[model samples]
Target chain A: MQFVRAIVRPEKKDEVLENLSSGGFNAATVVDVVGRGKQKGIRMGDIYYDEIPKTLILVAIEDADTDKIVDIILRTAKTGTDGNFGDGKIFISPVEEAYTISKGTKGL
Target chain B: MKEIMAIVRMKRTGATKRALIEAGVAGFTAFKVTGRGKLLDHSEINVPCKEKLMGMAASDVIDRKESEEQVVTFLDDKRMFPRRMFTILAYDEDVPRIIEAIIKANRTERGAGDGKIFVTPVNNAVRVRTGESGDAAIW
Candidate 1:
């Protein structure tokens, strides 16, 4: 199993979630977090927003489905054709184990 | 690549950030978390004496019998303290320096609850905009 964590712009959250659901990956955990990327942050006329709000979507899927799910997020989360600075990034990691709480069953 | 997760006292977050930045870390994510360590401070359990509750002075309560003591009960004994968790993704070579920086910023003479540091292997990282992966993506 692979654990995919995507941090995307807040506005694109629903679109990304919808796309993921339609892609047959419905189970996910979403959290509202504030952080900066390589650009550090953005600066306006007289204000500097050091902590930009973003949405984190977490999903656990079969290793073979990694590329498919990543593609779904990359496509739906991008702002424009070429993408923007805050388009967000996706991270893939190995999942050692998973368990179903109610049923006490293991594996996802 | 490695992911360094440092949990430190909330008040030391700024110091930790500065330390990480000075150590040449590109970027990191931080969030507020509440957790408890293995060692619990008994003094915080809040077991008030009956004499104090009855309006008796401290000196008078010292001579009081143990039966007069009142122990407050609660649903749970554990207390969670607020902390700041910093998640930093960096190259393998940079892990040691980053960990040192985080420890220096948060460590104090006081023992325990100083927080902890966890290092985990990252399978891969992707830069969404450029479609870059591996070391090329992280920097």
Candidate 2:
């Protein structure tokens, strides 16, 4: 299994979930976070916003589902043609194990 | 580095955070989210209305028992399981210990909503200020 964390714009969160749900991959955990990327932060005239509000959607899927899930996210998270900075980033990692607390089942 | 993501009950965030801190984890992120799992619930108010509208509209007093039975399956998909999720990045060796701390702090009962922890291997991490990457970045 792979754990995918997508840090995306707050406004794009709902749309991302909708697409994921429609894709028959509805199991996901979301969290609201604040951070900046290579761009450092956003500046508005005389104001500087160091921490931008972004939604981090966390999902665990089988290795086979990686490409499909990433495709869904990129398609729904891009800012326009060619994309834009702060469109968000998706991080993939190796999941050691997963458990269902209710049933006490492990391994995926 | 490995990322330890723990989704626990909202009420347990404080205890969980403290546990991680005591476990020598320096940095992490926490957020509020609603999810759906194996827990059974009867919180959906729309299910009854939809059923009544679909069933005999002439019955002004909808059958409570029948409505609940018909909608449990449908409502399962729509249920929201409120959770507080925490993400912690630590050295590979610290992963197990960190997870143990979280489990110790979060395991209030062995039922649904108790929570879950996912450990993922992080390929790389970068600390923007110092331009440090990999293990240094995580520390």
Q: For candidate 1, lDDT tens digit of each residue in A10-107?
A: 89987887777778775555667899988879989888888999988767778999999999999999987999999999998775444332222345
- The TM-score values for the models, in the order shown, are 0.46, 0.64
Off by over 4 Å in 2: B1-3, B12-31, B38-74, B86-112, B122-139
Residue A96 local lDDT, model 2: 84
CAPRI accuracy category, model 1: incorrect
lDDT of each: 0.71, 0.78
Error of 2 at A11 (Å): 1.3
lDDT of 2 by residue, B3-76 (tens): 77778888888898799889998688887897654324444544554565457534565676675555555455
Q: Please report the TM-score between candidate 1 and the true structure.
A: 0.46
Error (Å) of candidate 1 at residue B99 is 28
Question: Number of the top candidate by DockQ?
Answer: 2
Interface RMSD of 1: 13.0
Task: Score residue B74 of candidate 1 by CA lDDT.
Answer: 18
